[model samples]
Target: MAGNPVVTDWTTDFDHTDKAWAADPYPIMDELRDTCPVAHSDRFGGAWLPTRHEDVSAIANDTEHFTSRSIVVSEHRPPMELAPEGIAPPISSDPPFHAQARRMLLPVFSPQTIDKLEPSTRAYCQELLAALQGKDVVDAAADYAAHIPVRVIANMLGLPEEDGDKFRGFVLHVLEGVALPLEERIVGFQQLFEYLMPQINDRVANPKDDLISFLLASELDGKPLDPFHVVRTVALLLIAGIDTTWSAIGASIWHLAKSPTDLKRLVNEPELMPTAIEELLRAYAPVTMARLVKEDFEFQGCPMKAEDWVLLSFPAANRDPAFFENPDEVILDRSPNRHAAFGLGIHRCAGSHLARMEMRVALEEWVKVYPDFSLEDAGAVRWSGGQVRGPRVLPIQVGP
Candidate 1:
């Protein structure tokens, strides 16, 4: 196969899935962006790389042109029947269908609804921070970052507080990818499915004042949602909402720990939390890729066939010079910051408002109280998985 015309030092055989690659992708992405804006890599068994801001944005927004149906990496694509993410297009479903599925959960995640949850969100953040008081060093990932989102989701779903730990464990295992054995991952998925089934049944039998109940009660096109669809929808929310927010939280903590000045700034100007949230997302850019492809045309001179996958590199896009001035620097008060951290277009993250509220509350509270915290050891900050970017262990030494 021919290399991308724009690529100068293209190597299609490079393994993007290598452990080292996951550990620090920015350097490689930088190289790719500069030398090969549209390179192809055989790492995931052949996938095109579009590193420039315009290319990534175009692919992300033009769903009609670039269909979001198949896997970007051929090797990672699961069998059509067995793939949960692949089934029925769901978020990726074009237009009317996408809108329908999205609407199912939109009310629960609307900005007004998310704002109503702020008090509880702030309370949870304070509780987490309180537990860390007087500790010289604590793993932020395990102790603080990971717990908040899972707890919020569990509570929202009306699951018992006691079940949050178990649910979180299962979700973490599933996200660990190759770190956990294949059989263990399968078991985790099965456990998650089994765990939710009873809740689904209960919601159906006796609807409550919770998200699950709402889903059970709500109808699409004058008919109640199918049970399987309910399960899949809930599963999608559980996985996407929990992991992405968790990673963002962990990464934000890491960034702050690494920069005491930034921490101090946020502590002083609490209103800057919103802008800080966007900046954190821009710098870290947690979710790496969004898969899509053209249905019937060429994009940027590249002819894309039906079912061919094109990956939108948001992290790379956020850093592209064409979009943000001083893209690498963290400007806490950055306005007009339209970065697609949550994503763009119809499939943008449904729970983003809640996610931002969670992050803002967590940051505002944590920094205000623990302004003196710092990473216990820079080298000890290791991440758990590739698909998700987060510190596995973020030990911090905080003042009382």
Candidate 2:
């Protein structure tokens, strides 16, 4: 993969997991969108990569053709086999089943629920910002952005608030630990699940108001949720909960910190914070979903075979000029912004409201305190590769 040519055309065997590709994917995404709107890769058995906005959206919404049963087609991890009956819900199940699983979890993330959670979320943001006041240096990714979502979500799920940093470490290990030996990656997953089982057991015994407890007590498909299903859903939350929002928050702040003009505009006209967050999400989306081709299909002139993996790049789709004006530019108030940063269709992020609130509050708080910060050194930053991508370390100088 190191020797793979710079993505110049559709024929180029693009391995997105390659470090060089990870360092800067937009160029590759652009070339892929231009040349190989639907690309086939030799990796992961075989995959179809679609970068065009319309193509990705149409495919995502066309679930009858593609299924989310195997959303991860990792170069590092082994390909997962789908069970005859889907393993869990929402993420792994297609509609009817997907809707049932999604519906079971909807109340926890409803607009009203997220709005109710905002007051605590805001206070936590303020506490973090206030603690950084006297520091001349801050690692935005670690010292700041990383902690926000972990703490907020951990509390929301009735996990130990003090365990936030510990959970973040577990998440980083699994998400980026693929860079380590395969055994090490497995160990990370083991550590996460071992840590979780006790909580799941405790929830079953006590039946509290937390997410794990709620799942333990809740019914599914006209039956009480299976213990395995409850654990798997909580595990999914552990995986999805930590890094996606953390990456978006870190990436958006990193974008502003690097650009004084953009940072200042947001600082001066804070009302645009809402729109700015949306633009930032579009420009720096942190998640790309993969789907398994349910059957052979020819659409957009690309023939995909069943069992082929397809990466639906929301990041790439947001940058597609067909849907966005000046797709490359992060206009603070880009209205009518129809970006799929939270994804599209039935599999859209369930926690979109909470994620949006967290992003805006993070920027608002940081701008008030450290709008003038800059990177410690350009090379001080490092991006991680794998499904969830963002700056793993964002060292910044707040003042002299």
Candidate 3:
């Protein structure tokens, strides 16, 4: 096993294993971007740092050169070899297969399709907010932001709303481990696989209006999708959709609550909701990293080898001086933002449209009712680890 990377300079500082930096990595990232854009880190298992917008975007967009074969940097590899991420090959083999699967999943999350769900999405957001109406202090991440995305995804996947809490527990447990104890995580994954198998079987037996049902009924290349593929695809969606969006929403709310000026601006002008979402995503860069490697050659003048893990730093990219005029500030109406928060190229997040809608609805409705909310204890905000980045606890006091 390899060891974590080391940073010897003030410009390049990070303890990849440090819990504090995970809570708010921008400061360290800024240091790195200013001094060492391509600095190497031994703390993160020996991956080079690419903090500038151009370097990160170049690596992400040129998938053929820097393949998406190992999206996570954990010490151990996942059991499911063809798990629809982190490997490149023939469509039936890896990269191509992921592309095809994405095409099939796109319709379920298309802007048009997601727009149709706006009423239900907004209603749910209001309902969740209503539950928090009288509370003096609440952990917004747990009590509100995290729950909405999972519930929405559950409904979309034909799961019961009551199971949302349980599913979230499983997701947090699986993702939090830096080096997931293989046996325990494997057992957990197996249980999840077992839990979803019957659901897929039922969907196959009797199709409905949900995603699993659509997967079961649809044909890939003249034949029905393999049942295992459907399960893997749904599993990916559940993990990615629930965790990433939940974190993004939590981070957005945390930032806004911390800034009364920004909150006041948005509350006074509802039209800024959409731009606010982008700015928040850019400022926060919630998703940790996407792992990939070169298929044949080198990157940034470094000698390349097949399957060598590299981290694509989206948060760093979002703050690159070349991309945004003032990378650190929250410009709500940041026009031509063109960020890689949802990633870039073919594998960009399939659920981005829905994610935007969810955030927009949550912000539009939450600010309307809780415009006066303020952080209960600003220093109390904590973040959890995993492929996702977000506040673990965001306590706030809401009132008129």
Candidate 4:
């Protein structure tokens, strides 16, 4: 019970099931890093929170010591398995094997691929921003952040851009674990599968020039991928699409709304947007990943038990004082940023390129059209709770 006193602090302790942590976790995260760098919790059948930057990087990269078989920390629900094989490949998979799936998918979104797609991406941003013109208020999360990735990912998957809203619902329900029971979230996954089953099957029968069709045509060891494998990959793609950048964009806007000086700098200095975004990525870093302990190993002085959940708080890692100078402050053009917002190791976020592009465009366009804006109502602004974090309802006062 040595760790209990600090763990029971209640004010700073973190548990995924606790609604309080979701609202504002930074204070508790600060407490953990300062006091218990490697803290334990009883909520999810005993999970470890690695608060320091080096600890997170070490755990995430050491495949021999930790496994990516499961990343979600839940007492009742095991981590969702990826399809293509026993592994989810790249994201939820260990090295070597993860590379197999990753290699094939990389060319799809390679620099060359995205270069060709940039014009369309720009068009989408303009179109979305144009719709909000003349409006006094904006739901940055839903109106701007939510719609861009939904449409972009939809277009990548060959789904209609109009279906973006429907995709947003599934992503919010399943990944965010927002206002719904665990069972309901499971059903949401099924709903997406059922919804896409016919299209996936159709792609198999009559191959098209899209991601699904491309996956269907792909061969491993000269054999076509299994249907389950393909569907699981699609599920990962769907859930991953909207929320990550949605959080980054919402958090960035929220920061600017709270900081008029920073907002003004970017609005006037467009060239600084790139590095400024990097700084924001570090400060508002989202997405915490879990690695299943492969064996009973003493990791950085902490005894990690086998199969126990060891969550790498990339967000916390980004805020580490040792790793970053003035870790709390968001310095525009913060250089030498080695944050793990995208993640570390072979499972580093596959969509990092798309995410940056989406975010840059989102912020660049917003600042161009709107002047310095502030939170419409500070009390009503809401953030999402779950592994992937973001503001679900971001109301900003942009117009007079």
- The per-prediction CA RMSD against the true structure, in angstroms, equals 4.4, 2.6, 3.2, 3.6
Residue 240 CA displacement from its true place in model 4, Å: 1.0
Determine which window of 10 residues in candidate 1 has minimal summed lDDT.
Answer: 1-10
lDDT per residue as tens, model 3, 155-251: 9999888988778866775566555555766787787788889999998888888888998887787799888878877777777778788888888
Order candidates by lDDT, high to low: 2, 4, 3, 1
Where does candidate 2 clash, by residue pair? none
Model 1 collision count: 4
TM-score of each candidate structure, all chains considered together? 0.88, 0.92, 0.91, 0.92
lDDT per model vs. reference:
0.72, 0.79, 0.74, 0.78
lDDT of 4 by residue, 271-360 (tens): 998899889998988688888787788977777787778878898899899999989999998888887898988778888888888888
Q: 28-136 in candidate 1: lDDT tens per residue?
A: 7777778767766543334566878888877777756655554223344445453223543365455556677777778899998888889988899899888877777
Residue pairs that clash (backbone atoms under 3 angstroms), model 4: 84-229
Candidate 2, which ten residues in sequence have the lowest lDDT sum?
Answer: 76-85
Residue 157 accuracy (lDDT) in model 3: 94
| Inter-residue clash pairs, candidate 1 | 65-294, 66-293, 66-294, 67-293
